[model samples]
Target: MPLFTPEKAQTTDQAKQNCVFMNTKDYDDMVAKCQIKPLYVQLNGVVFLAKPLAECPKDKIMLNANQRKHARISLLSNIQVEPYAPQHSDYTDLVQFAIVPRKALPFDSMNSDLLQKEAISQLIHRTVYDQPLTLEFEQQFFDVTAKSQTLQIVTNTTFFKFSVPHPASKNLQLTGDHVESAVVKDSQLMRFVKQTQESMKQKSDGQEQPTDDDNFELDIEFLGVGGCNKQFADIFRRAFVPRLLPPQIVKQYQMQMVRGLVLYGPPGTGKTLIARKIGEILNAKEPKLVSGPEILNAYVGKSEENIRNLFADAEKEYEEKGDDSELHLIIMDELDAICKQRGSRNDSTGTGDSIVNQLLAKMDGVKQINNVLVIGMTNRLDLMDEALLRPGRFEIQVEIHLPDKVGREQIFRIHTKRFVAKNAFDPEISIEELAELTPNYSGAEIQGVVNAALSYAQTRMMNAQAALEGQQVSLKEFRLLKKDFIRALKEVKAGFGKCDDKQIQLIQQMGFLNSAGTTPIIQDIQNYIQTIRNSSIKLGTVLLHSNSSGTGKSSIAAEIAKTCGIEFVKFISAEALVLKAATEMERCNAIVKAFQDAYKVPEALIILDGIEDIIMYTSEGMRFSNQILTTMLPLLKRGQGRLIVIGTTSKFYGMQALDVTKCFYKQIHVDGLDKTLIDEIVQEWCESRNIKWEGGKASELQCIIDREIVTIRALLQSLEQAASGCNEVQCSDFGKFFENTW
Candidate 1:
């Protein structure tokens, strides 16, 4: 057909409907010639499904302002309209689109579903991408942007994802069939709509909108809690949303609603915080918060009555609305306090067991209520009853573990956001560095670190004010420097991965240091520490042995424990156990307790110093304690959390005979000093300590080094005694010392 000049219609229903005006003669001629069904016209490299305007004059084709603007053509430009026949792959029934207003739209002023109905009614069967079609509603223009995949030929299944304005959409979600869902495989346009919808929802909930640069995937973020995006998503998907499904669909599908969830992890890992925010995020009824101890009453039957009271509101709601009631959230902190195993203890009154029975009845009884959601938080999951954790009860268990490096960094940001916003932090304060500095800090500990840093800053400000005379201190000048964080690190120690300074100090006082390149054995021990740290294998054991005593085997084991960088390190010394416990059974009990404590931490290093002493080894008939060995063997080899057990012993051959060597993953032999090493160490010690040594005169020292092995500990002790008060020493003086010592 010959091209006709496009004209903009200022006031016409055809213009608002994105239709092209054509004269009666031209429309009849084109329809008869092409016989195109669901007529489509292409202009200016863009395609649009066109509608005929019957009120137009003959020989003229009309272009509304929206159609002309969408094609980027002017009124004076003549355009050739071609019928669009889409290929097989170029069609899509559903198009997820977005509506961007010229300004922010107020809540309740527009309906998202109605706007979608109008846009889809006009632009269906049109291939559109990047070009936006304007729809006027309530004297406001909303730009409807859709991709080519979403805006193709419309079908009966054609559905658009429409997002409502904040606060208004909280109660008025899109009705009937086109609500937000991932039923269609997610596309770029669909992802955009999801992000926009979540953003609006968050704003409606009165939450701080996430910045464009924030990369957290989950929709919920609670104040004073970080690194729990995944856990929150799991709880919402598994426990919260299922209870909100319409009763008819749930009944037809024969699906039981998820009513209970258990959040268990190490203390200070944010389990309680997540439980408290469940009701706030879901916009459900205010959660009935109760501590596990608070549920128990001193009087008989009162505890069971307290348990029944928690479900009273939900029971009433279920009676009124059946399956259509609003969700009722009940969060119980320290759940293990009340939910102990049913027969774990004998109660005279049976009050505790009855409380458990009452809770079970309320959660999953024959007359079940579907409106209630229970979130239980506990530090000790093993103490809870097995029946409570079964599928029909609190089946969803989420472990709120210690945060990783990225998670720790996010937690630091969350805690320090207010300080950062106020510009109270110095330029050198790096959140990433703070995260690295704290390896095993929980969410609560990270918050404590921030508070500690602020305290340091406050102390510095007070000192400055005290030192200056007639000088006013300004709050704006309060800056948190790098030194404040360093000092904060000292104040707030993580309970999990803490270095034992007292044990390290005792080792230093004993004058055993592997820090210098004194021997290749020290380097070998360091490599074992690094291997355990990097390995994915969760459980491992290393044994360090020497044939002789005072060979620094225990010192090397302590060094390994210090450097392993695991969350827990237990130094179980046989000497300390003997001192603390008089009976042999008590000593064995203490040894077992140490291993059990190590299991509670995610990653741990246990140093069994003097393993022979713990097993009560005696050379005279090759006697040892079988009970202690039995207690230590399974604990060393059992695979659970990430654990590395370092065992040091002076009796290598004895351990081999007992088949204890086979239990370890790796074994390294530590050697005493040879003759050549002894000669070098004596000369260096003499020079460093400002003592004079006449080498030729020390015949006894030379004879001992050549004929017998000398350990570092033995040599150092003799040197300290011989050179007690003398600035000058002779080799003949060593012969006098050996005469008395050897």
Candidate 2:
């Protein structure tokens, strides 16, 4: 039995008087009687004739045709014409027929009318072998009728009640080779047959609906641990501690989850990398990495819509999977770009604040979106809205700072180990020394230095490869060429040089020291030098303040000697004062002995270079023990004739604490040149090398100053490289200098 019900007559009176039969031929008359025009004529509940049933004049038909004969044949065959009605009893094997009129129909019944007509047409063509079938109908004019017995007929122009066989009893089992199995099975095909239906009743009463999976999970891994300090890592680890528990325990405990974390730092300090690493460490199942720019939209209100969509989509994904354990990590890089402070009326209105507001609302609306963690990275945390950083939002603020000496050395080792394995150089060249020398170098700078060294080595190897048929870089070649590698390390010019001459002169003039004879002199000198050096004067003592560098101290002292118009003499320990050659007094006498020789010279400047090696600071931070001070006091206080004893100490503070300040009339600090001086030196160097400074070359000189305000020696070397093998000092040539210096 079919589920479809068709209009049917209940009584004999209604069946005989109201029911009307229609064929393709009588469709027009039937439609006319009902004050409608037939659009399609049906047979066996399927449309057999769908052409317009109106009559057309021969002339009108011929006007549109290539030949009048063709037009006349189509007009007569395709159009429906009147036919005799069939009796209800004669329609015992009646096929259902649907009649569609050429007028607007109600929205609800229009689809059914079209589908019935189509199904009837298919049945006639396939099962009925294109044979026409008689259709009988009983029409009722009453407004009301019984719900089950009522037969409602809807046409394009009017509503009428029709009596026909019950739709279930009239079900035609479609047959024939022309029937498509796919069409019979297709729901859409069934809809075309006026059998469209949807199940409204619940499958099982009182059965609970299955809940959607609302949980998200994520697995994050930190590769190449980002440049986060141990403290920061600890904080991050603590924040995600709960996530490390077993699933069952985690569910039972209801851990206080960390929702958001922010990484703040200067540009190029690896905030983004740290954020990424933290995300990896958290090990969320679905971590969404989004750049701040992704949230912006071109149209007004569209950015807010996008933000909403992003969260909505994430929730939808969790829901669809029906998994509560899924973790969602939203990593926002350059967050300051999209979460700026709200603008005042005077400021341009559109900005990150609007987007920030949307994010804030979403974040606050949910108490425990357990699996979702928001990590934001910003170089300019100050520019972000305060609301974004408040207690519940990005509460965990981690700072990513420039690497310190130990960190830099670790970074350098990581970067250069490959190069070291390939090239032959002293592996013992002191990374500690390198770290000390690279004062303010960031991790990126350390990498650059290593890369520059490798490049230099490659260039040398390339030249050598051309000369020698196929020779690996030999130890000798690496030693000779590895000067470039050392040069690369020197490029970052850590401004850890000695104090300058002006500072030394100022300390002397300040009368911080009192001259006395023997023991009194050494003690007074030590006190004066220490006081002046450690004072809060804008400039400290002018003594060379470099670390343990023998060559640097010697060169600087010799230069000062020459500048001061004094005979510079190196005082070897053997020629100076001595007690027992092995005793502590002997070491003190050795220093005093050197000073005595310089004091004997009327105006000689003695260079006590590498003083820390000769004299050690006592535990009191004073340079030289009391016993050594006793031996040196006499020579220092003697003040031989007009001699200006210029003792250069690399460790000036250590020397001061030794109470050796009274010996030298003036102390001169020799530090690295300022940018202005460096620039002047570079200009002079370019001129001396005959390198033309064309194309606003002064600016290029200034850039070098800006990049690395190095020592006079470093600046000179850089300038030489900038001018090397070129008549004109082009800006491009500066790269070699920077490569060598950085």
Candidate 3:
């Protein structure tokens, strides 16, 4: 039997008010041909609406055209989006768009010169008008074509950013027979659809806040399953740890079971894995994995019906089993697809809003089903609906952050255990050293690193077999070497290494002894930052200058920006950009674009790393464009917006020309660490390395610094070597470190 009564479209006026007007300019008969359902009609002076096929008076909802002539769709429900009845759809799960892209919209460029960038943006904006819509979902139905020009777009997330590579037309048409779009199953289409939404949201938001999935802490009890410790901590510990306790005890204390648990982190950080484990560990009964489009229907009312149907089984089981009911686990992967922040998209057709309303009602519904548990996972945590993350909803929100050094070590051991057990991996494999090298590698990335090394070893064996031709290659003799691991480490880079409080504290402590010199350097910069914050100083660029060898002026500048409580810090390393962008124009554009991005965030700190490179100062001649310098002066001046620009320069005088030097509020000199500061650094390094630093050792370290050290970088290196060697810097070690130094 049908769960609920479907509403009908009453009149043309009602249609104008509720339904999207089908303005078929090219095809007039298309509207008539379309299946507009819940169609109301007056048959022989009686107004009537047809019921669902499950609970209907007749077999067909629509009668002959002669009788249907007066039948107008009072409400457009039961509309068959597919040419045929959707075979893949589940009544309990609601609408499932299982279509795959046989053909896609050309996003390369617009037909002619008349197409503006805004026009293309408008096209995309228009395309995403209905539902919690995604590009791929829309792409399945329509083809975005220009008048004459060739266009292309890239959906290159993970490897590259999804961006509009070329301009598109203003009146770009969307017309196609969307019948043959199904290439894969329902779950895949929904994944592609939601992923498209993520890309679209990112493109629209302007600010690209990077997702962090570096390292994860794994449960010690689950060594074979070790790597995602933080994931387990955030999920199982908070949500299910209490479930393990005696039911009577939990009830006596009025212990509340979490209604919903959300595991939000970067991609490949084991959010989904955590959810799957919850189901496995608890042995949840009939655990439902609802992708975004599971409840979304093309027809009105049908989608809502689908939402109701999803909970029907759980509701029935709860009533039958009462308090002794088994847990009904609902794992909603990519929660952002259906439950994004309310009213985020202005052009929303209320379908997403209705879905959220249904979910909210079900979660906090009148008839309490304590047995049901909803676990949501998403890469885009910020985009999820606020109400969904409220106290009664997904109350326990834990961040699955990147693991530290120790966490990485655990991850390494787990990933390499298979080979270790088989003796195919050498015992001499330095897991600690490998962990250190893979600083910001995610759990998945760490697995990749191990797999990469294994691949190399396999390749080596294969090569040997091929070269020998007749000789039998020994598989047991071929083991993973240090070089293979090193090669993998070199390939994978630590992503998004932001400057935080630790970096700031490191700079804060490492200062000269005297109050007059470098000790006051941090204080001076602090004062400038305060001035900018209070709006007392004419907000502009501040230069950190140093003639001292390896003085770390750039490091100080970054630390200053971080310490100043600035949310938006755009660290523009001129050297990083200038090297990549060969032309002077390209270099300027890169810098200017970064500067513009900084302006997007109010009270932003733009750190100009290696200022000399931007100015093209080599003490001989300046080859950089004068236009760039002029453009930079006003931007550096902080003429508008709460902006603070901090730049570092080894040669301060070289910036005297190009009018850039005059822009700085003050030039603070960064001096090398004094003897006291050196000792403090050495002590920390020794403790971190598990080396004793007391009595004779301290004196030896001080002597080495006082005699040979010129910078904190050099001091740390010398101390590290000394601690490893004999817990004290030998006089011979000092001579070897600085053979030619005064």
Candidate 4:
């Protein structure tokens, strides 16, 4: 069943002669005689026919019958065969001789066609000088040629052609000449290849021109124009610009535009929020929000390495992909943790300085790597390295200050918009007035006020649940809620409640004038005491130009009785009037009371000591409040009793508005402390108590205090909160207090 085998073979010369004759029958006959079934036959280096063993010719005659059968069997079973070797001239038909049983092929039997062709090829090589033979098949003819002793083989459908190497003598001079010629040709070809390669490279480099789409610039608007807020925003925006560009191209441009930005301010001023908003506005492609702690590394150089890798990776991404829109914004909040002031010897220089130097170099390095923006946020800007702030570096500095009246109003409206939209108020109160009352209120404080008001309303509704209170929050409820909201705010002391130089000056001015007025003694005392307390003096004086109703005198006296630091109290009435007995005895007792009060509390003064009553004749006749003249006459004398005092007036013009006689110590015409001062007092008071100053700022403080001139009782109530731990005073506190008093 095998197509070919070693047992059935032919002499190479005989096979070659047969192939030259182009006799298919003879070839088949010869193969049959040899009992060789040629599955594939190669002639003159060309394959003529290749078929399976079973498909090969089966007509070759063999003896059959008794003796003939025995001979045929002997021929089939014991035919003598020998390995074929071709003479040099036999190469002409080498292709035919190479075909044998597929199994007998020297190469792998599985690929007999390929092996036959290889054998023919080798015979051709060995006999290159031998003339090539032409074989004419049914459709075509083959021609084989040999040149320079190298085999040139060609095959057609009908014929195969071959050329073989010719033998030549070796000559040193000639060989050298050929070698030199070959080298020169090779050198010329290599130069052309190199030139072509360089040209292609140049074209590729040119195609990568930087585009605007790869670069981005952001403009962030911040709080104060002249303050750190704007500077910081600008610096941050610049830092982000280079990050938007292709790093490689951007580097080529050598424009180091992008750098880190840092913002710092008071705690509640919204520093972090503003930074986040900036990121949003810039619309970073890939924003990395990191805290200061994230950059810290335990290993000496690891942190710096990590930082370098972070930026490097970003740049590499842009360079490799050529995506211009890719942006990596690294926002480092609390930047002070790692980038602390540089010169501290105790700090870890290797770790800290490495990070600092690396960050510094990356931010504004001369190399101009684009596509990375670093933003640093901190509450402690003072603690950062100065190099980080240099022009090419962070460059921009922004500071957010406490909101002013207008800003407070805007903030209040922003926070309360939801409530207002729900029809919480029938007629909205003047926001300007609210803003005025909330002095030193930050954005957080305004928001807290709105929240407090809403919370108060909710609480009230819950308490009235059984009454079937409507879901709607009414104007009345809102007002009441607002009042309670304000009152609660007075308990926080952290904001602007602490007395500063301006506040102290205002208190001193108010306390001076209240003691000089002379009207009905009781009324004068009331006016003076109210003015001093409303000024938020905390420690000061009250002088009353009054007599009679020492009950009213004692009432004012009792208001600041619990003042912890320093407070003075004195009552002037009929008993002292009698002791003096002068026509101006009542006024003299009023002055004496002021002196005694000052003596009692050298640091503070309360002047309502002893005075019964005073009567005065007015321009309209009919004995008008003479209490004013009687009180002023003694106060004008200026004796040992010259400090500060509170005065009241039941009747105006009952005494001169001013005592040119220099009678009373210092005259602080008692009217009312301004809206700003009132707001500050409440804020200060609440802050001391550790209460949150939610809404109701300085202006609001003033509005509530001024709504109805602050009375001695109101002052006592406001001050009483100081004992309850509500340190910071807010406008809302005074508003609630006033509402309750009403």
Which candidate leads the pack in lDDT? 1
Model 4 scores a TM of 0.36
Question: lDDT tens digits, residues 291-383, model 1?
Answer: 999998888889988988999988987676444355688999889988999988776777778888999999999888767778999988888
Residue-by-residue lDDT tens digits, candidate 2, 512-607: 211101223233434543554355421122244443332133444444433443332434332232423676766765566555444333233444
Q: Write the per-residue lDDT of candidate 4 for residues 175-204, one digit (tens) a residue.
A: 111111100012212222334345435646
Q: Which ten residues in a row have the lowest lDDT in candidate 2?
A: 179-188
Ranking by lDDT: 1, 3, 2, 4
Taken over the whole model, the C-alpha lDDT of each candidate is 0.71, 0.46, 0.55, 0.44
| Count of backbone collisions in candidate 4 | 126
Which ten residues in a row are the worst by lDDT in model 3?
154-163
**Model 1 compared with the native: what TM-score?**
0.68
Off by over 4 Å in 3: 1-224, 227-234, 250-254, 293-297, 301-306, 470-472, 497-542, 545-742
Model 3 agreement with the true structure over 1-742: per-residue lDDT tens digits: 1111123334433221212222132112232354533222223332332222222222123332212233333333443211111122211111211111234555422222122222233222121111221222222322222111111111111111011112221223222211111111122223333443454455457775555475322243232444555556556556654554434455578776677888776565556766776665553475788887676788987877876877787788766644444567888888888887778867557888888888888887677676777888886677888888887788877655555566678778878877888888877789888887765566777888898898899889988988999688976878998999989866654442335555455554543223213546767878777777787554667788765445667556655665666655666766567567887778777777666545433456778877776756677655655765665777786644567788887776667766667888787766666655554554555565566665335444454455533665555445445555575554446435533333
| Weakest 10 consecutive residues of candidate 1 by summed lDDT | 180-189
- What TM-score would every model get versus the actual structure? 0.68, 0.37, 0.44, 0.36
The whole-model C-alpha lDDT of candidate 4 against the native structure comes to: 0.44
Q: What is the lDDT of residue 248 in candidate 3?
A: 42
